[model samples]
Target: MAVSRGCLCCVKYLMFVFNLIFWLGGCGLFGVGVWLSFTQSQFSSLPLSFPSLSAANLLLVAGGVTMVTGFLGCLGALKEQRCLLMTFFVILLLLFLTEVTLILILSIYHKELDEKAKDDLIKGMKDYNKNTDLKNSWDNMQKIFKCCGVSNHTDWHNSTGTGQLPSSCCRPGTDPCHRWEEPCYEKAKNFLLSNITSVLVFGVCLGIVQILALAFSMLMYCQILRAEKYMD
Candidate 1:
């Protein structure tokens, strides 16, 4: 069955929001990448849980690139420019690719860190054996570690005391035998790091969908133009 131009226009109009948001979100993600590229310290804080500087740096780069490309996509959407949308799609696809790898690295790191921390606490406890405060201290250490699960990295203090410091564990090697190796809420921070990748992936995928929609709309518009010329 033949579709009327009016019907086609209605479909495109309905898709407008989809196109608009895809570009806007894409741009924001790209901006993050730019910010990370400029500030080494911020980059270091990122992937925020990975020990390997390389992994952290890579995530930062991915983020910055995604952010910039995404922002450009937003501009293209606003302008309703086809070539620009295509360019933005390429960058968005790259962003998705990087995000996939980042997810793998993150899973590996999280598992490894969890094991290492458990081993460290166990060994530390054994070393303190026979010190009358040993059991109490170990128990307290375990408690502090558990406390860390609830907190975020930003709240952790590099302090010997957990007093008023959120997520700051018992100062490691110190008595009451407490210490924080990283910031408090190490788990939450790791979750946050991984969460970004998940979100960006979903966003890029949505952008892809929007691009497909735009492609169809552009094709329809071209067809209409051709049909009008032929009739004339």
Candidate 2:
């Protein structure tokens, strides 16, 4: 009986630590989402249609849900509350299933998604001057991603009537950098594709953690029920 009690205590504390980390991760996601939204709003006057806005919104929603569930899990584990633990388990299970489905869909339709993303990037470039937000976003993408037009630097020749490329296409430390020599579309596409594996790994790790948390919660719930029955 003493060993069983000790084991239960260990599980309870482990769950508490896990939930705490989960809560902190959720908060971080929420902060990033809010920052993205605020940044986008700064260019409200521009007719920019950010494709990433939906992703930011999703991060916000997912973060909020994770935070709430984390809190419940922590509290229920500490207090040995069957109801709260069960509730946490159910929510975690649902989230895990949703994430799995998302991963599967993304993996299956990655080619389609990649083409759509490329098209959107090209469209944004075409309208870069039409909207301040789009211009800023494109400039940032080019500079940060070290990319230029959708296909190549020549892609910009058709878009800009002045036959001048944005300074972002120029290499650093060069006063008159040859923008025509630098092509961004292929680089950008490669960069994005390279990160797909990392993203999938991250998702799989998170799903595994969720499963462990769900299992721990169920175990604690059952223990609570057994203890109550023994006492009666």
| Top candidate by lDDT | 2
Stretch of 10 with least lDDT, candidate 2: 42-51
- Candidate 1 global CA lDDT score: 0.48
lDDT by residue (1-232, candidate 1, tens digit) is 1465555455445445555555455455555544444433422322233332333355456545645664565555455455665676566666666666766765778677655644443343333334535434433433533444223322222222233432224544555635454432354345445645764676567557556645544554454555566568
What TM-score do all the candidates reach, one by one?
0.39, 0.70
**Candidate 1, poorest ten consecutive residues by summed lDDT:** 152-161
Question: Which regions of candidate 2 deviate over 4 angstroms?
Answer: 1-10, 24-64, 157-164, 170-177, 180-186, 189-205
RMSD, every candidate, angstroms: 11.0, 4.7
TM-score of candidate 1 on Cα atoms, chains taken together:
0.39
